[model samples]
Target: MSLSLKRFAVLLLALTPALIAARTEPAATLAPEANQAVTARMVYGLLSDSRYAYAPRQLDAALEEDILRRYIEALDREKLFFVASDIARFEGYAGKLAEAIKGAGLEPAYDIFNVYVQRVGERVAFARGLLDAGFDFTQDDEWRYGREEAPWAADTAELDALWTKSVKNDWLRLKLAGRDDEQIRTTLDKRYANLERRVRELRSDDAFQVFMNAYAGALDPHTSYLNPRAADNFMQAMSLSLEGIGAVLQRQEEYVVIREIVPGGPAGRSGQLQVGDRIAAVGQGRNGAMTDVVGWRIDEVVQLIRGRKGTDVRIEYLPADAGVDAPPRQVVITRDRVRMEEQAAKSKVLEIEDRRIGVIELPTFYLDFEGRRTNAADYASATRDVARILEQFKADGVDGVVMDLRSNGGGSLNEAIELTGLFIEQGPVVQVRDASKRTAVHGDSSGAVAWEGPLAVLVNRASASASEIFAAAIQDYGRGLVIGEQTFGKGTVQTLVDLDRFARNENQRFGQLKVTVQEFFRISGGSTQHRGVVPDISFPVTLDASEYGESTYDNALPYTEIQAVPYQRLGDFSALLPELDARHRARAAEDLEFRWFSEDVAKFRAERARKTVSLNEAERRADRARDEAQREQRQAERRAAGLALDEGAFDDDGLQADERNVVQDVARQKAAEDRPDPLLRESAAILVDAVDLLAADEGRLAARVLRPGRTSTVWAGGADR
Candidate 1:
């Protein structure tokens, strides 16, 4: 229970686990050789449990040492302008860490670089060793680290050379710490004296957990492996209510890169933050001093950014395309409570073909977990509000509705069921099965139908989780038309478990675990695991086609199907497919924006296919030319959307009136045109056809209901149910 250890836990949790993956459960018990202290034992158990699922090969002690040495050397060689004095100060911290680990019988510092204890220590060191041995590490190499061509080697000479260099570096580092060369060398020799004793006292479970953590992190940001203990901790995922900055930050290369900004998040509202912005520093409150964040871990940086709602957080950012020497600017933003209203489905009217088409963009099925626990408004309440909006659109005489679930990651299973119910008349939404094989079916209990009009769902590469389920159900039930890019393929469900739930002391902090428990299947019996929910009609969008979907991920499960349940269809809307397709094609061909998009896709396709890059200066110049062409194409896209053409004007300094004016003009023009979104125009025309068919089919029931003797009494005000 030291201050640093507590800080470590807080910061560690801040680091998001790599993307989801299928993994074997790790051992649950603590290692036999774990430290006697409860906290140390918890750390030891986690490291050895394999629950954290660190990549074993990469996190070996020897590997970590090597990687650490190389990373440190790189930092020094780059001369990031760190003075010699700073090195001494850094070494002082390292010395203290080593001492603490020894006194506590914890193997904290495994390598000279920041790859301290846990699984990363070994993998990074081994990779560095390979590099030092004059081995070629290329894409083709079998090993995760090192050149693909020379992935594995049986000889020890090269590896030995690397270890020798690492040892010399360690010695030199110690010498510079005000220790005489002899004393430094002696200390180094003495450092190994207790190695055997420490190893014997080390817990195997801790080692295993550390291994899992390292391995899992190497994948993408969402995948992870959980041990049984951790799995059990997250039975009821707690929802917290807080205003989020609305930006997705990830560790990319050596920097924390902004992946995407939620359209209405505080960050998104400010319009200063964008995908690919690099955060270099953060300042607290209004007028707080900025703290430099270079070389800091992703989680640590996140901790600094999170605070009480209604507070101001100042961020310093460098644009993605900025040069190494480019200066960054500060953006002071006020954080607010992020609620469903901010991240939920927002409606707009798009006129494409002289028809007013209703466009509802759903960001996520987010239910405030913390609020729900405290009996606050839930996802169902938010969906009800969205339903009200949809009704208003219906009353407004909109042609059709576009339910856009482009980048939604999903939240709240109950909300998913309720939302589905809002679209479809009383039916089962989804089925959930526990580990013991018991099944629970969730249904639409309200019998409330929101809008039964023509519907088109828009999705893309980033859409996943509940997004897939809703889209699949809609497609399976023939309730709507799916358009746009392919959906992200994730059909699995995860349960987050807190390890400390069953352990002693919550603050003892064993950490929490998220484990896959069940897989979702469509009513038609098909699983949206690897294949995802395919759009009925696909659109040519961005180059993300190559960069998205579960198919491109490693260790992804295969798609499967079960026997589909029979549900009577209230009506059919597919009869107008031919007319809809033809109309859409014609509109797209004539629209300048669509034409621009088509051309850009074609030009980028050719460039994206070139995998090899020439090292020659002349050839490099050709590459630059290709890149510039791509940029120009993007610029033209902005103009097509009625945006400002000045590149410098888009910088983080501030927004220009021209930019805002262009955006407003585009929206206003689209509004005035009053064209049904070509996509929805076709949907409306089909719905109108369905209305005709319903009238034709009602020959018997209509006759009976309209009979003078069997007239139904109409109440002035009544509840049908």
Candidate 2:
């Protein structure tokens, strides 16, 4: 039981024959395979000794308490299964994890989880019985769905009452989804059984993964522990077939949440799959019975999801904006390989009357590393693709350009920097601060400018990482106007370390650690950690920043700043914002599309704030009818205005088209072209306003970067359009 750093796998957990796809009942005993103290010591040593972590600290009494608290919260999210007595009984483990880890004395993690399993088993049986008792949907009662912040129940009686409502809520959801009483009974009964089975099937390795993750999460939300079995399963899946409903899944509390949707993938093509949506159940084909994956291990969930191409997979999910009490909506995605072309930067011109505003849609900051290394002539690079588009825009004599980054979850860091370089002639783009307090300036030294025209960068809550870097660089240098919602505030960089690399014994398997090693900063010095790049002129957004962005994570890093770097200032968007905002607001108020978008956003915002739902059948049905009528009314308006197809066969506000029907596709595409995006048009309008404003006051405008001794200003011609 030595706490030596050299024995990296000293705390490896005993494994069962379960290869992640099986759900057999566990054998009698769950035991440890190696020394926890030695493994903990090694893992901590790597963390503390890293030259990059934000602030790796010792496992002192204070940190130990936080770790224990995090572990408890992870096990009993929503405070459902655990009673006040259970938590009180585990209080002795508080401020004791550090000592226990160092001395190989920690038994509290397993003990608490064991208690959790028993509690879940009891709750499951009670919930199943509640279904048999039958729910009275006629009652005008409200069911409280979210209880993450609620205090633990004082006694089992209180817990039973809570479970009763929870079970009722479940039954009501199924009924709303069109299930009959018998069908709802059977479905809910199976769901409860699955929950119980999942809890009982928690292997020793699964416990270790959860406990270590709690420690990591106490430090920062981005920090994580990836168990070896899960990693192996993913690798095997990737090798076997590159087919699936392409959505990145991550374990959050008891549910698996969608982290990102791969462009051109089945999930993205379906358009219903969204980032932050929680997966409740999964099924194969069109009508297969869904297997409850609420509390299943991530690998098991993955095994069910990734399958052969052209296969239909139904995913029942809680919408990103919906509360836990909301009825689950399912989407059937036909799985296929992701097409890289769909992810590349593409261009279009919004020709409204006399103005031709060039728009470039960059879904991600992509770079073909292999092609670049091999010097492949046809390789795809965001910078290169965008540069080409800018050249075309110039050739077409466009008025302004909008770099659309909405829903663009970032990719390559180098691409962000290089893309930033395209607009600015040779300057620092972003800065990186390592754990050792060493700052490195990463910039573009290409000494070339792609486009010097009036520019605007559009962003949203889903625009993160590399997207933030690009938008922040553009905003910091006054290079462009950042418009729309504040970006996803993910500024830290992480690297995965395989523990097996340090293990002396081949059989001793440790997991992998994803450590946050650095932070991203704009050239202007502000880190885009928790506080993302705020839009210069904002648009109406339904997503609450506190609930949707990095701020949602309790352990996200704080915003900080370093010394500013030297860069030439372009035109000042701040000075023109007052007039620009006034005009924009006036236009938005008058525009029918903008008004409708705002109305929808308002409705979603209201729905998001609802913590409880009416159980009354009449009330629920009335609400449903009202919502449907509203949607139908909007559809009618679109048809009346010729914004929709003449046949009225298309919905989705003319945003999506049926590719299979060529005639309908062309009509829908035409309708889509006719239907202008309010935000994008507004952004282009702002950029145009900036151009005019700059022309009115040339003294404040520096459209071209002037070198110390070079005064050609040749790039200034890009603004002439």
Candidate 3:
């Protein structure tokens, strides 16, 4: 009976495909069924009243034009589905979406999305038909894997050829992976079917969210709209469910992009994934057949990823830092629950010659806001944990400190100020200004200094938000030397608003809107919005800032500066940077580890510069072999030198890759602990040089330590908290 039913269903799909599509139905059904008009008005009203909004106003003709362009781009980012005629048709709605939204009408958004849905069905069908015939890979050809910047197809004929090549490329990838023709065909058939099926599954709410994000994202990339399910997922994460890979995924084009890696999670701990990487496919267990997830809804992909603890889930992802045309890499992650303890600030003392430099590795700036508000004595927070670590460091007779904020995606604003207070007695930490120029200076008022010795703050591309606040404050006060690559430029603040609260229907779930409300600046008068914090002693920047950072967004808030607040300088660290930099460069030149790292980065960048890949099976095999050889060679050299190899977290000995072993997890942590951190070691060495430099200069450090910062006109909430 089941086989008969399946056959009947296939016959039904083949005969009446239009019945499955909403666009072919009556026009009234095409419009959103929910209260999108009310929701859109509520969003606009909130942004309009906010003084810090970068793009709040009655939607003018210019904004309308931008919205229309953005809306279409969101629908077809790769320009594969939409042809010239389709875009030409959409241009008629240009500069008019504002009036439609203002009048509580969303038909225009629906119209565009309906067309996109139809186009996706057409493309998926085209791809499936091409797959049946297969391709002769004997002919030499190249597939343009990167097409975000490609021009739209002039006609359907142009689109057909593009899809032909695309499908051919897909077949070649599987064939090279050693799959039989029958297996490859089955996988491709399922993938194409899923693509079309998921598009059919999309509802009015999904379409509304996409349109709303396009509207909000025009002003700033961080501003976005979350549907009811998405909002619930976000709240669950905030409450710390800690299941799955524990990464925040956002939709971009057809892919689910990694936005943030949750601290203490398998993904963050293993470093197998990074922000901006897009998940292309997912599979279960150690070697389950991969299911193509491209164009699947964000929530659906997430559902596939969420699984039982200690089980393996394989993820195929396009790495963010890997340049265009890079092949997707597969990783098998053993799921584990994230413990809050792992996210807490940790400290260890590094012995450099005759002195001890305390290193505090802060994975994130976490604070239990409700706990703190209720005066819970044991509320978990970054500042409190770091304060305790500092006390321990003092007891250990540590000469200097390194606040390692590497990969520290920031948290509470109040915790940043409190954390800054640990090093400096009292001073302005950050300056925030609104749209109409209402500025508020947040500072630390506590008359307590945890560590007054020479300090260095280690940062990288991932350090952001509150991390920037502390690092910038330390730099402004001359309290510490900011070391490593430039910090992630994300100095904007956002407030989440529940749209349902303002809706007339109490039962209607209008979802949530995350709007940018304020942009903060360093106390030294520069905003870390686009131009992140530059280090006093610089390291070779491995991640390209243009590809990462806030600058990558289309209309991110521009970097600006306000008045510098009054803050006492700790010492003349700037005056000594020249010599300090000189000494750092000299030492790094001869350092074997640093040289190896630099060489690796150079090779990676060179590979990333390519634009296309050969479709020939032989060439593709050679490429994969070369990549594997390079990776194995690096691990071999590290093993030879008795260094730790980055084999990910769950490199199980006896059990399958998917099976969880608590004992193995502990062992892996031990191995990681013993791994030599070349960057931290170098930072400690620099701090040692600074300690000696100050001591030799006779009371320079002492004089710098004596000066305490003065009070400032602070904000209402942050400084005190």
> Per model, how many backbone clashes are there?
67, 2, 1
- RMSD (CA, Å), candidate 3 to true, equals 11.0
lDDT accuracy of residue 540 in candidate 2: 87
Residue range 566-628, candidate 1, lDDT tens digits: 654432334535545665667668755465557657765554444222223344335445656
Top candidate on lDDT is 3
Instruction: Write down the lDDT that model 1 would get.
Output: 0.50
Tell me the TM-score of model 1.
0.54
- lDDT per residue (tens digit) for residues 1-721 in model 2: 0000100001111123352223233333455446555556566766656553576866777788888888999988788889999888898888667765565654777788788887877777677667666888898887776677889999999999988877776666557657788766666555565566656777877887788788877778878776777655433332222468877676554677786677767888788877778899999999999999986677789878878888888899998678878999999988885434656788999864457789999887766554678997766688889999999998998877899999988767888999998888788989988887789999999888888766789998899999999999988777778999988899987765767776664653776777888888888888888888899999887686767989898778888889988877554555568888998899888876678779878876675567676778788777766766766776788777777422322322201111112234445555755554778877887777666655555534543332222211322343444
**Comparison by lDDT, 2 against 3, better one:** 3
TM-score of each: 0.54, 0.73, 0.74
| Model 2 residue 58 distance off true place after TM-score fit, in angstroms | 0.9
- The positional error of residue 262 in candidate 3, measured at the CA in angstroms, is 13
Worst 10 residues of 2 by lDDT: 1-10
Better of 1 and 2 by TM-score: 2
- For candidate 2, give the lDDT: 0.73
Clashing pairs in 3: 51-435
